[model samples]
Target chain A: MVAAGPNRIDPYLIPALDGVAYGLLVFVAASGLVFCFGVANILNLAHGMLYAIGGYTAAALLDGGWASLALALAVGVLAAAAAGVLLAGLLTPVATGNHLTQALLTFGVALAGGSLLVAGFGPDDPRVRVPAALDGSVVVAGHRYAAYRLVFIVVAAVISAALYLVVRRTRAGMLVRAAVDDPEMVACMGVSPTRIRAGVLAAAGALAGAAGVLGAPIIGPGTDTADTVLLLSLVVVVLGGLGSMAGTLLAALAIGEIQTLGVALLPSAAPFLLFAAMAAVLAVRARGLATRWRTT
Target chain B: MRNEVIRWGRGGVAALVLVGLVVAPWVVDDYTTAILARTLALALVGVSVALLTGVAGMPTLGQTAPYAAGAYACAVLGSRISDVGVVQVAVAAGAGAALAALTVPLVVHARGVIVLMITLAVGELVVTVLGRWRSVTGGTDGLAGIPAVRPFWGLPVLATDQARYLYTLVVAATLVGAVLLLLRTRAGLLLRAGRDDETRLRASGHRVPLLVSGAHVAAGAIAGAAGSLLVVAQQYISPADFGFDTSALLLLGVVIGGTASVGGALVGAALVIAARDWLFGVLPGHAPLVLGALFVATVYLLPSGVDRARLRPRPTDVPPVHPDRPAVREHAGAAPELRT
Candidate 1:
C-alpha cells in the first residue's frame, strides 16, 4: 500500500525549495510574455507552444544521446530561439490591435502543435530524468534536497539578474521600453518597429526555450505540458501588468509560492485553488498594480 | 433593375438549397446522414457563436461549455424519463440560460483579449468540473446508453434514419430562419449598432449592458439546445464534447463560413464537418496539418468573413434607372422641359 501519513518537517523544506524553483521557472516563462505584451501588444496564445517546442527538442536530443545533457539543453534552447524567430516573422504582420484574430491564430497554432506532438510522441507521457552528475541530494538545514533543484535556482536567478541588467542598462532595453510606451514615437525616431519586435520576440523565445529545457526534468515533457505552462504564464502575466518585466517576476514568485502552499496545505483542493486564485486576482486587480503604481 | 433581378435569383437559389437539404438524407448513405446530423448540431452551436462573435463583437471562446451543459442536462433528463426530446431540450435551454446569466454580468464588461481569456477560463472550469464531479456529471467516463430519439408520431418513420435527419433538418432550418427574422427587426439593428459602438449605443439613451447580457443569454440558450440535440443524436455525452478544442473548432467554423450571416454559419459548419469526415477517412494522420493550413489560409485570404457582403441584405425593390437624361418636368402650369 502507498504510505499515507502526515507531512514531515524535512519534506516541508522541500516545498520551500520547490517554490523557489517553480518561481524561477515562472519568471523565465513570463519574461517572454512581458516582451510580447509590453512591446508588441500581442497576446500570443502560442507562447506555450514555443515552450513545448523547446521541451520536445530537448527530449529528442536526450533520447537520441546526440550530446551530453548540458549540450542537449543548449541545443534545445537554440532550436527554440530559431523557432521563435520564424514564428515572429509569420506573426508580426498580423499582430496588430486585433486581439481576437491574434488569440485565434495563436490558439490554432497551439492546437496544431499539441496534436502533432501527441501524434509523434504517442499518447503516453514522457519523462526526462536528471543528469547523473546532478542526481543526488545535498543536506541543507537538516533536510535533503536535490542538487538539480539548487542549480536551477542559482542559474535562474543569475539569468533573471542578467535580463534585468540588459533591460535597464542596455540600449536595446531602452528601445524595448520606448516601443512599449509609444510605438509611433519610437518609429518617428527612425527605428524600425519590425526589427525591435523581432529582436524582443527572439529573446523571449530563447528565454522560454531555456526554461523549458531546464523544466523538462522537473515537470517532464508531455502532450499537456504546453497547455499547463501556457495557463501558468498567462496567470503570471495577468497578475503582473501587461508590459512590466519586474511585475512578471514578482507575480511568478507569488504564484509559485501559492502552488507549493496549496499542495502542502490542501492537496484535495489544490487543483481548483489555482484557478480560484487567478479569478480572484483578476477580479481584484483587473489592470494590475503597475498602472496604479505609475499613476501614483 | 439588375440589382432586383440578382436579388430575386439569390432568393430562389436559397429556396432551392433548402429543398435540396430536406431531401439530402434519403439520397445519401447512413454515414453521410450521420455526418450531416452532426454538422447540423454543430451548426446550431456555430450560429450562437456567430451571434456573440459576429454581431456583438464578443470573442466568447466557451460556447462548448454551455453546449455541454445542454448535453448533460438532456442526457440526465432523457435517462430518467422516456424519449421526450422536446421537454429535455427545454430543460437544457433553461439550464444553459441560467448558467449564462450567472456569468454574463462579470463577463459582459470584458472586451477584446480579456473576454477571450475569461471565457476560456470559464470553459476550462466547466470541463474540469464535469470531469471530476462524478456524481452529477458521470465524471470522465460520461453518461452513456442515452435512448435514441423517436418520432413524435408512432408511424414507422422510414426506420428512423431519414426521420432523424429530417428532424435535425427542420430544427436547423427553423433556427436559421428565426435568426434571420430576428436580425431584420429593430432589436437586430440595435444589436448591430451596439456592436459597432457601445458608447454610441449608450449615448442614444439605450441600456447597452442589458442588451449585451440579453444577447449572451439568448446565445447560450441556443447553444445549449444545440448541445442537447447533439447528445440525442449521438446517444452519449462525454467531457471531451465540452473541451477547449471544441470551442476553438466552433470559433473557427464561424470565421471560415462567414460570421454575421446565419446561412454562412450553417455553411461553415457543413464544410468543416464534411471535410473532417472525408479527410479522416482518407488521410487520417494528416488531418491536423490540413486543418491548421486551412485556418492560416482562411485568415490570410478572408480576413473579413467569407459572407461579409451577404451579411448585409440589399434593398429588395428599386426606382426605375434610365441612362438617358429625362426631360425636366416643370411645376404646375409650366411647360414640360420644352426648352431642353
Candidate 2:
C-alpha cells in the first residue's frame, strides 16, 4: 500500500480491517488453549484437531443458509466436544505424569484422529459455504472485504465477554480455577477434580469448534489445517504469557497485525515474522520467569 | 544370579547388534540398506535428543532445527566447497553448533513444556526460512542432485548402497561412542545434577546455565553431524527431512530408548524410525493411525515408561510447590496413581 494522501484510498485500511477479524478469530481459537493449558494445566496438543473437527463439519454441512449455519454449528460443537471427552478419557492414564507423557498421548491422538479425518473427508481442501447473506465482499472505505470474515469481530467479543463473566462470576468457573490452584482443597470440598477436567476439555473443545466453524471460510479445512491452527494458538498462548484474559486478547491482536499488516508492509519477510515474534517473546518470557530454583 | 543374566543379556544384544551392522549390506536388499542408512543418521540425531532430554532434563521438539541446518550446510558444502564426507560432517557440526549457540539464551533458562514450545518455535522458524529462501534452499522443492561424497580425501566416492551404508554405520558408531564417553565425564555428571535439582546445583556454586548452554551446543553439533550423514546417505536434502514428524519420532524414540542411556537412544531411535519408515512403505496411508495407537498403548501398558524417573508419578517427587516444573502454579499432585 503506497502512501495515499487525500484523493486515493489508503491500502493499509483493508488489511487493518482484516487484521481485526483475524485477531478476533485467533482470540476465539486461543481461549480454549488458555482454558486447557492455562487454567486446567493440561497440555492438550490435539486442540487444533478439535477445531478442525468443527471446520470439517462446517465444510460438509453448511449450505449457505442461516439454518444450515445453526445446524453446522451444533453438530461441529458437539462432535468436537465429544472428541474432547474422548481425549479426556485417554488422558486419564498419564494425566498426573510429566508434560512429555501427556504430550506423547495427546500428539498420538492428534495424529491418529487427523489421519482418520482425512481418510473420511477425502484428501482435499474442502470449501466452507458461508451464509448466503455474507457470501460476497462488502465495500469498506473503497476496498472490497469478505463479509464472512467480519463476523469474527462481534462473535469473538461476545465469546470473550461471556468467558470473562463465567470465569469471574459462575460457580463452575470458580471450581475450575480452584481445582487448578489447589486440587486438594477442591477434593476436600466434595468436587471430583476429574469431572472438572472433563468439563474443561469439553469447554475448550467447544470454543475451538466454534472458532473452526466461524473461521473456516478464512483458514479452511485441510490436512495441514490442524497443525497451523495448533501452532498459531500455541503462539497466542505463549505471547499472551498464559492464563491472563487481557494478555491473551492483546497478544492475539498483535499476532493478527503481524500476520496481516506486517506482511503487507514487508512481503519478503512474511514467513519469518510469526516464528521470529514467537521466539523473541518466548525468550523474554523465560528470562522474566527465570526459575525460582535459582535461589531456592 | 539375576545380575549375571541381565548383564549377559545386554552384552549379547550389543554383540548381536554389532554383528548385524557389520553384515547388514550382505543380507539386506539395496532398498532396505538405503532405509537402514537413513535410519542410522536419524539414530545419531536421536542420540543428541537424548543428550538434552534424558541427561539435561530439557525436553525438546526442535532439535530438527540443527539437524536441518547441518543437512543444508552439508549439501551446500558438498556441492560448492568439498565432497569429502569428513569435511562435510565437520562443517555441518560447526553450522549446527553455531546455530545452537545463537539460540541458547532463548532455551537455557526454561524447563519442561516451555522448553519444548520454544524449541518447536525454533524448528518452525528454520523450516519457514528454508521454504522461503528460494535462491538458497530451493523453496520447498528442496535441493536435489547433491554430489556424491567420499568418506575421506583418499577414499573412493561411495557409489554403492553397501559402501554408503558402511560409511554411515562407521560414522554413527563413532559419534555414539564419543557421546557415551562424554557422558561418563564430570561435564555429564554436572548436567545430570542440574537436571535433577538446579537449585541444589546452583547452591553448590555450579554454573547451571553455562552447563546447559554447553550441552545445547554439543547436541546441536551431534545433530549437525547426522545431517551430513543424511546427505551422504540420501544424496539429496530437503526441509521435510528435518521436519516436526522427524523431530517428534526422534524425541519419542529417545524416550523409548531410555533417555539416560546413549546405546538405548541409538536402538530406540532406530526402532521407531525403522518402524515408521516400514509402516509408511507397507501400510501407505495407515501409518499414522497405527503409530498413534502404538504410542497411546505404550503410555498405558508400559507405564514405567521411557524416563522411568520422570514418568512414574511419585508423590514425593511432585511436591505441591515444586519449583522445577515449568508452570509451578498448577497442582500436579491432583491425579491418583492407577498403580502404586
Candidate 3:
C-alpha cells in the first residue's frame, strides 16, 4: 500500500476534493428527505421525482448564463414545491395508514411521474449547460476539477447554515420540532397537522429542487438520475440515523468520499463499495440505532 | 354452518384452479404459455415476499437479491454441476438462503420500513455486482441461452414451451404446497406471534429475532427456488428481470393477494406479472403509467390490503402460550391455519 509513496497522494487529491463537493450535494438532496420523514413522518418516495423536476427544469431552461441559472433555480424550486403539494394532497386519504400503504402510494407517484417526465423530455439523458463563468475546470494541487463542482462546497455550506438557522432560530422550526415530537399535541394546539404536512413537504421539495439544479452538472438530468439520487439520499438518511442533521451531513460526506476517493484508491472494488459501506455502517450501528430511533 | 360452507367453497375453488392449471398449457398458444411459465416463477417470488412482509411483519422490497442469487447460481452451475431441475433448484435455494443468512444481522435489527430500505440496498448491491461481474453475468445484457432443464433424473429435458410450462407449474405448486404445510407447523405459529408483538413473544420465552431470521431464510430459499424456475421458464436471464421494478411489482402483488395468504400471494403475483406483460404488449410505453395508476388506485380501494378479515382475522392479543399450559392453549386455540 505504501509502495507508491507521496506520488499516490497527489493523484487522489482531485477525487478527495470532488468527494467534498459530491458529499455536500448528497447532504443538500438528502436533507429534504430527512425533513419530510422526520417532520411529517411520511416517506415520500416521490421525493426523487421532485428532484428530477428541478433537474429537467435546469436542462430545459438553462442557456449558459447567470440569468438562466437564477431563472432555473426559481422555476425549479417552485415546480418541485408544487409537486410536493400535489403529493400531500394525494396522501391525505391514506394519511393515517401504515408504512406499506404510504410507501406504495408514493412509489406509484414516482413511477407515474418519472415516466411522464421521460415522455415529456424524451427518453434520453439531457445535457446540462453550466453558466459561462463556471464552464471550465480549475486546477487544484496540480490536478484539474470541474469548477461547478467546487461551487457546491460554498453553495451547500450556505444552504446548510441557512437551514440550521431556520430550523433552530425560527418559530416555524419550533412548530416542526413539536410536530415531529407529538403531532396529536400540535393538532390540539390548533395548528392543523394537514397544513404542517403540506408545508414540510413543500420546503423539503424546495431543498431537493435546489440540489437538483446545482448538482445537475455533476449528476445530471437523466432517466436514471432520480433513482440514483433517491438511493443515495436514502442511504444518507439511514446512515445518518434518520433525522439528525449533523449525522446526515457526516454520512453524506462519508458516502461522497467512499464513492470518489475510496473508489479511486480501490478501483477493483468499485461496484461493491457504496453498498458494502452501507451494510458495514448499518451493521455496526444496528441495535443501538434502531432503539434510538424508536425512542425518538 | 357459515364457516363450514366457506371452507367447502374454498376447497372447491382450489380444485377448480388446480384443474385449470393442469389444462392451461394445452389450451394456450405457445407464446402465451411461455409467458405464463415465467409468471409462475415470479408468482413464487411473490409468495416469499408475502412470507417476509405479511407473515413475518418485515416489509421488504429486497427478495430480488436472493432471487438473483438463485438464478445466477443455477445459471452458472447448472451445466457444469448438474442440469437436473431438482439439483439446480437445491443449489439455488442454498445460495439464496446463504445470502439471506449473511444479511440477517443487517435485517433483523430493524422493523418495518427500515427493513425495506436495507433489503433494497441488498438487492441493489446484488444487481450492481451482477452488472459488473461481466464474465459471469454477461453484464447488463444478462446471461442468455441457458439450456432447457430436466425436471428430475431419468426425465426428459424440457424442450417445448408446453413441457416447460407444465414443469414450472408442477414445481411451483409443490414448493407452494410445502410452504402451506410449513405454515401449519409450530414455527409458523411462533412467526405469527412474533410479528404481532415482539415484546410479548420475547416475554413468552420465544426468540423473536431468531424467528425473524428463520422466516427470512425460509423466504429466501423459496425465492431462490423460484429463480431456478425463472431460468427454465424464460431460457434466458438478465439483470432487468430482477430490477427494482420487479420487486415493487411483486410486493404490490402480495398486497393485492392479502399479505398473509400464500395462495393469495401466488395468485396476486401471477396476475400482476401477466398484467405487466399484457400491458407492455398492448400499450407499449404506457405500461408503467397503467401499473403505477393501478397501484395508486389499489391504495385507495384497499387500504389494509385485500380483506385480511376473510383470509386471516387480525389475531387479537392472545396471552402468550406458556410452555407448561398446553391445556389452556388448547381451549383458546387460534391454532395454526392453512390460509391457502
Candidate 4:
C-alpha cells in the first residue's frame, strides 16, 4: 500500500491511528449494547438516543474551556443515564413480549427521543468544542496528530481496560455473566433477573452517554447522529456476534479501520465498505463472528 | 344458497369500495387526493409487512430495499425510456423481486432477531449503495424528472393528482384483495402454521425456509409496486424516501392496524399517513414526538391494533388440533390434569 516515501511517514499510518481512535469510540458505544443484549436479553434500539443526548448536553454546555468541558462531559453522562433509566421504565411492561414487540417499543422510544432532541436543540448541527489543553497537534512517531484524537485514544483505551476488568473480575460482572448464560438459572439462585437487567441497562446507558460526549468532537453531533451511531453500533454488535464482548471490540476496531481506510482510498465507496465487510463476515459465520454461550 | 349469498355480499362490498375510491378525488380537494395517494402507497407497504410479519411470522425491516429498488428502477428506466407506462411498474416489481431473491439466503432459516438484523442490514446496504452510486442515483439528491405514469392499453396518462390518487387506490385495493385471497390458500395456511411453530411445520415435512422465502418475495414485489406507485404519485424519488425511518413507520402501521389482517393494514396505513401529513403540517418538527408517543401508546394499549375491536374472539373460536400429532395430543391431555 506504500507508494514513495523514504523520509515521510506512511500516509496509511495516520488513517490507521484515526481508525484505532474511532474503533475505541465504537467499542464504548457498542459495549453497552453487548451487555444489555447478552445479559438482559433486551436489545435497546434507543441506545443511540442516549449517546445523542450526551453529545447534545456536552455541546450545549461546553464553553470551550477546560473546566467547563470536564463538567459538561460529566453532566452529559449523567443525563444519558437518566434517559436510560427512563427507557428501562418504559420498556418494563413490554419486556416479557417477543423480540419483535420489544424492538418496536424501543424503536418508538428512539423516534420520540430523537424528535425531542431536535425540538430542544433545534435541527442545527451542534458540535462539542475540544478543551484548550487538547486543541493542538502532537508529534507521534515523527508524524503530527491532533492532540484531541490522541487524548481520545488514551481515554478510550483506559475506559476499555476498566470495562474489561469490571466485566471479567467483579461480583456484579459475575452476576451479569451468569444472567447472560441463563437468566432463569440466576433467578432460581435467588437473584432477581429483572433487577439485574435493569441495572445492566442503566450501566449500558451510562457507557453510551460517555461515548457520546467523548466522540462528539470527532464525529460531530447532529440531527441524524442518533441514527448514524445506532447503525454503527448495530453493525458492531452483529459483526462481533450478539452478546460477545471480545467479538464486539474486535469487530469495532476492524470496522473503524475499514471505514477510515475506505474513505481515504475510495471516498465514494466508503459507506458500503463496512456493510460489505459485514456481509462477507456473516456469509462465512451466519451467526456473526462469534457464537453465544450455550449452557447445554 | 347461503354460500352464494355470502359470496355475493362480499363481491357487493368490494364493488362498492372500488366505486367509492374512483369517485373520492372528485369530491375531495387536490391536497387531500395527494395525501390519499400517499396513504395508498404506504398502505401497500404496510400490507407487505403484514404479509411477512403478521401472516408468515417473520418480522422484517428489509422491505425498504425492494421498495427503493422499485423506485430507483422507475426513476432510471422512466427517465431513459421517455414514455413511462404500466410496463415500467412491472419492471420495478421484477427488480424488487430480484433483490428479495438475492436476500433470501441471508434471511431464510435465521432466528427471529437475526432475521430482523440481517434484513435491516440489507436495507441499510441498499441505501448506502444508492447514496454512493452518484451517477445513477444522483447521490443524496436522488433521481428526479420521472415521466408521468401512463395507464395500460393506450389509456390516457395520469396527469392530475386526482387521477394518480385513483390509480394508486385501484392498485392498492387489488393487492390487498390478492393478499386476502392468498391467505385463504393452502400456502397461506402453511405460512400461518410456520409462523405459529416452524418446528412443527418442518416435522410435518414442509420446507419452512422455502415457505418463508416465498412470502418474503411476495412481500418484496408488493413493496416494489408500492414504491413505483409512490414515484408516480409524487413524480420524484429519493434515497430518503426508502430509509430505515420509512421501514419503521411501515412496521408501526402494520402493528397499529392489527397484524395478520388485510383490513388492519389499510386502517394502519391511513392512520400513519394522516398523522404524518396532518401532524407535520400542524406541529412541524414536533410531529415525531407525537408520532413516537402515539406509537408507544399504541403498542402498550392496543397491542393487537385498531382492528382488534372488530376481531374479538368468539366463544366457538377454538384452536384446531391435529389428530395425527401424538405429541400435541399428549400435551393437551396433560395440561388440564396438571392444572387440576
Candidate 5:
C-alpha cells in the first residue's frame, strides 16, 4: 500500500484518516435514514435537505459567536429535529403504505427545500467556522492532521456507540425495532406506531443535522450539497440494506475508503468506483449486504 | 358495432392531433413551434418511462443516463459522419441500449426504493464520468455546433422550422404507436403480470429478469431516439440537459399523464414542458419551487393522474383487480390458486 518514497507515511495516513472521517460522517447522516425506513417505513428523500438546513443553520448561528460551538451544534441539531417532526406530520397523512407516493412526495419536499435554501443563502458555497479549540492540527506518528477531523472521528464513534446502546439496550429502542418488524402487530399491542414513527423521524433528523453541522467544514455547504449528500446516503443505505444499522456502518466505512482511496489513487476513475463497488456487491447479493430487513 | 365506432373515433382523434401537430408551426409563432418540438421530444422520453415504470413496474431515476448516452452518440456521430440523420438516430439508440444492457443486471433483481437508488447511482456515475472526460463531452460546456440533420432519401435537406417540427412529430408519433402496439402483445401482458407477482411469473416458468431487461432496452431505445430528435431540434447537447432533475421531471410527466395509458405520457409531457417554460418565464428563480409544489400536489391530489379525470365510465370498463389481495383457496389445506 505504500508509495515508493521515503515520506510515504503521510500519504498513507492522510487518506486512511480522511476515509475514516468521511465514513463516520456518512454513517451519521445515513443512520437517520435507516432508522426512518426501519421504524417509520418512510423513505424520506428529503433527509438530505434536513442535513443542508442544519449546516446552514449552524453556519449562520456559529458566526454570531454568542454561544460556544457545542451550543451552536445543539441548536442546529434541535432545529433540524423540529423541522423533521413538522415534515413527518405533513407526510403522515399521505404515506398510507404507498412507497411510490412517499418517494415522490419526499422528493418534492427535497426540491422545494433545496430551492428555498438557495433563495435564502444564494448559490455561493457557505463555510462553517470551526471553533478555535479544534482548529489546529496534531502530530500522529510524526504526521500532522487536522484536529477537527480527529474530533469528528471521535464524536462520530461516540455517537455510534450510543446509538447501538440505545437501539439494543433501551425499552424505547426495543419498541422501535418491534414496530419496524411488524407495525400491525405493534399497533395491535396498543402501541401507537404513528407516534413512534414521528419520534424516530425526529431523532433521525437530529442525527443528520448533527452530521451536517460537524461535516460542514469538510464537505462544505452549497446549493447542490443536499443532493450530493442524499446520493451518497442513498448509496450507503442501499448497500447497507435498508434498515440494518450494522450493515449501514459496514457499508459506509467500505464506501468511504473506496471514495477517498480511489480518488487518491486514480482521480479520473474515482467517481465511478463507488457505483462499481455497489454494482459488484449487488451482483453477488441482490438483496444487498444484509437480509434482516427483507420484509419491506 | 359500437366497439368499432369507438375505435374509429379514437383513430380519428389521433389523426386530428397529428394534423394539428403538422400544422402547428404555421399556426403558432416560431418560439411556440420550438417549444412544441421540445415537448414532443420530451414526450417520447415519458413514453419510455411509461413502458418501464408504468408497464413493467420498474421505477428508475437513471433513464437520464441512457438519454445522455444517446445525445452524446448522436453528437459525436453527426459531427463525424455526413448526410446520415436516420443512421445517427439508430446509432444513438444502440448507445442507449448498450448502457441499459450494462446497468440492467445490477438493477433488475432489486425492487422499489433499491431500484431507484441503484439507478440514481448509475446516473450520477455516468454524469460524473461525462463531466470529467472533457475531451469528448466538453465537460460542463457540452457538445455544441452539431451538424444539421439531413432528411432521408436523395432529397433536399429540411431547413425550415416547420419541416423540423413535422419530422419530429412523425418520429414521436411512430414511436408512440409502436409502444402502444407492444403493450397489447403477450409479452407486454407478461411484463405487467410480473410486476404484480414476480414469484407467480417465475413459478409459471417465465424469465422475469429477461422480460425486465427487454423492457429496459426498449425504454433506452425510445429515450435515445428522443435525445437524437432533441439534438436535431436544438442543435446542441449538454450534460445539464440530462441530469437528475431531468429524470425526476420525466418521471413526474409519466405519473401526471397516468402510467397505464399511452396517451397520458404525451399529455403529461406537454403539461410539464408548458408549465416549466411558463413558470421559468414568470418566476425566473422559483421555477423549481413551483415545479416541486406541483409534484407534491399531483401525488397527493391526483394519484391516478389526469387520465382518470378525462376517463368516462363505459360499459366495458371493469374494476381493476387489487394486486395486494391474496388469492383464495378452494379448500382450507389446498394451495392457493393463481388469481389471474
Candidate 6:
C-alpha cells in the first residue's frame, strides 16, 4: 500500500476530505446531545429541531444580503439556544426514568418546531448559497472539487479544537464533568445544578444551531430534514457511546465514511446501510459503552 | 378496604364513561363523529403506551412498530381475504402481539434509558424494513387502496361517515374496556407491583419477566388493534402512518391525559388528535411547534399527568387534588422494584 505512492494517494483524497468534513459536522450537531444525555441524563428528542431552526433562520436571512451570514448565523444560534433553555426549564421538573414523558414531550416539540418552520418558510424547500468567496472549485493533484467544502472542513477543525479546549480547560468544564460523575456531590458544593444544566443545554442547542447554518447549503432545508438530521445525530451519539466527546468524534468520522462510502458502494440501500451498521454496533456492544454515563 | 372501595367506584365511573362514548356518534354531526372515531382509534394506541409506561413502568418509544405491524397485517389480510372490519382487526391485533412478544424478550431485562434505546432501534428497524423490503411492505409507496371494512356480513352497512364513526367508536370502546378489565385482574396487580419494584416482586414469588413480557404483548395487541382500526377508517396504510411521529403522538396523548387510566388515555388521544387537526388547519404549518410546546407544557405542568387525581379514586363530593410526585412515590415500606 505504501509502495503505491502519490498516484494512489491522489484518488482517495476527495473521498477522505468528504468523509472528514461530514464527520466534523456530525460532531458539532451531536456534541450537545452528549452533554445533556451523557452528563445530565436528560433525553432531549427535540435537539435536532434546534439545528433545523437554525438552518431555516439562516436561509431566511441569507436572502437579505450575503454579507449578513454572520449575523444570521448568530441569530440562528441564539434562537435555538433560547429554545433549549425553554425546553430545559419546562422539563427540569418532570424528566425521569419513565422516559415516556421525556420522549413524548420532545417529540411534540420537534413536531411543533418543524410545523412552525413550515408556516414561516411557506412550506417550500429553501437552500443557503455558498459564500461567493468559496463558491468556486479548485484543482489539487489533478482533482477538481468545490473550494467551499475545503473551507468548511477547515472551519470544522477550528470549532472542534475550541470545543476540546473549553471542555478540558474551563472551570465550567470541571463542574460539568463533576455533575455528570456525581450530581449530588456537585450540588453539595454549592454549585447550582440547575444553572449548569441550563447552560449546557443552551450551549448544545447553539452548537446544533450553528451546525444547521453551516450544513444548510449541503443538506438544504426541507420538510423531512428535521427528522433526518435528528436520526443522524442520534446515530452519531449512539455510535460514540452517548456521552463521550472523543467517542462521538471517532464514531462521527466512521459513520460519515459509512454514509459516503456506503452510498458509493451500494446506492440503492444507502440510507438503510447506516442503520444496518448501528444495529451491528448495538449487537456487539449490548447496552452500549455509554451505559456508564446514564446518571440514573 | 378503602383501596378496594375506591377501585369499585372508579370502575362504575369508567362504565358510565363507556356509555357516553357509545352514544357520542349518534348525537354528533358526521364531521365531529368521524373525528371522534379517529380519536378513539388513536386512543387505543395511547392505551397500549399506558400499559407499558404507566402500569408496567417500561417506557417504550417504539410501540408504533407493533402498531404498524398490525396496520400492515390488516392491510394485507384485508386485501387478500375478507374486508370485514372485525376480521381485519383480529389479524392486526394478532400480528402486533406477536411482534411485541418477539421484541420484549430482548430488552425486558433492561430498564430506564436502555429500554428506550432498544425500543427506538426496533422501531427504526421496522421502518427500514417497511421502506426497503418492497414485496410485503410495498417499499416506500406503502400498501395503498386498502378496501373499506364492512361492519357485518351480508348486510350492506351504511358507509356514511356517521355510521363508520359509530362502528369505530364501538370497536374502540369495547377494546378499551377490555384492557381496563384486564388491568383490574390479579395479573394486572402483579404488573403494577413489578412497576413499583421488580426485585421485591421476585422475592414475592412472582415471575417478573413473564409479567413484563405479558404487558408488552398486551400493549402490542392494543396498539395493533388501533392501527387496524385506523387502516379501516382511512382506507389506506402507509409506512408514514406508523413512523416515529405517530408513536410520539400516541405517547404524548397518554402522558397528557394521564397514565394508568383508560379514560385518561382516551381523553389524551382525543385532545392530541383534535389539537393536531385544528392547529394544522388553522395555523397552517405550525402543528408540530404547537404539539412540541404542548408536550413541554404538559410535562412541566403535570408531571403525574392531567388526570393525576383520577389515578386514585377520589371522593365524589370533593374533587381529587393532583400533586407532584417529587421524590419517587413508590409505596412506603415496600418500594415496588422496577425490574423484569
Tens digits of per-residue lDDT, candidate 6, B1-340, equal: 9856655665676667667777877787777776677677877788788778677866666898888999899888888888777788888999999999888656566655555566777888788888887888898898888766787787564477776777777788678768767876889878877765566678779999899889999989988988888776776767777777777677667667665555666667677878887787787555667777777667666664632222111122343233554212322111111111
lDDT of each: 0.71, 0.81, 0.82, 0.76, 0.76, 0.74
* Candidate 5 Cα RMSD (Å): 6.8
Clashing pairs in 4: none
Q: What lDDT tens digits, residue by residue, belong to model 3 across residues B112-184?
A: 6667777888998999988888998888988887877988899999989999999999889888888878887
lDDT score at residue A260, model 4, on the 0-100 scale: 87
Question: Which model is ahead, 4 or 6, in terms of lDDT?
Answer: 4
| lDDT score for residue B79 of model 1 | 79
Interface RMSD in angstroms for candidate 1: 7.6
Kindly report the docking quality category of candidate 4: acceptable
TM-score of decoy 5: 0.89
Tens-place lDDT per residue, model 4, B139-201, is 989887787877786787788998888778877777777877787778887877776656667
In model 6, the runs with Cα more than 4 Å from the true position are: A1-17, A63-67, A91-112, A140-143, A276-296, B1-16, B151-158, B306-340
Scored by lDDT, the top model is 3
By DockQ, the best candidate is 2
- Number of clashing pairs per prediction, in order: 0, 0, 0, 0, 0, 14
Name the weakest run of 10 consecutive residues (lDDT summed) in model 4 chain A: A287-296
Candidate 2 residues A1-296, lDDT tens each? Answer: 56568434376877877788888888988889888875557777899999999999999999999999999999999999899989888887674546677777888899899989888898899978889999888887777888777666777788888988998789988887676566778889998767877888999999999989888887899999998899999999888877777888999988888889888988988778888888887777774533321111
Compute the lDDT for candidate 6: 0.74
TM-score of 2: 0.92
Q: After superposition, which runs of candidate 2 have C-alpha atoms over 4 Å from their true positions? A: A1-9, A95-97, A290-296, B308-340
The DockQ scores of all candidates, in the order shown, are 0.20, 0.49, 0.39, 0.36, 0.36, 0.42
* A1-296 per-residue lDDT for model 1 (tens digits): 34345435556667867888998998897798778877877667778877887777666666434255678678767867776677668677673655555655666666676668778776677666666767789887877888888988998999999999998999999889888878899999999988887787788788888888887776667877877888888878877766777888888887787789668877767666666666555545533432432221
Q: Estimate each model's TM-score.
A: 0.86, 0.92, 0.92, 0.89, 0.89, 0.86
TM-score of chain A of each: 0.88, 0.92, 0.94, 0.92, 0.91, 0.91
Worst 10 residues of 1 chain A by lDDT: A287-296
lDDT of 4 by residue, A101-142 (tens): 666678788889999898888799985788888889999877
lDDT of 2 at B211: 99
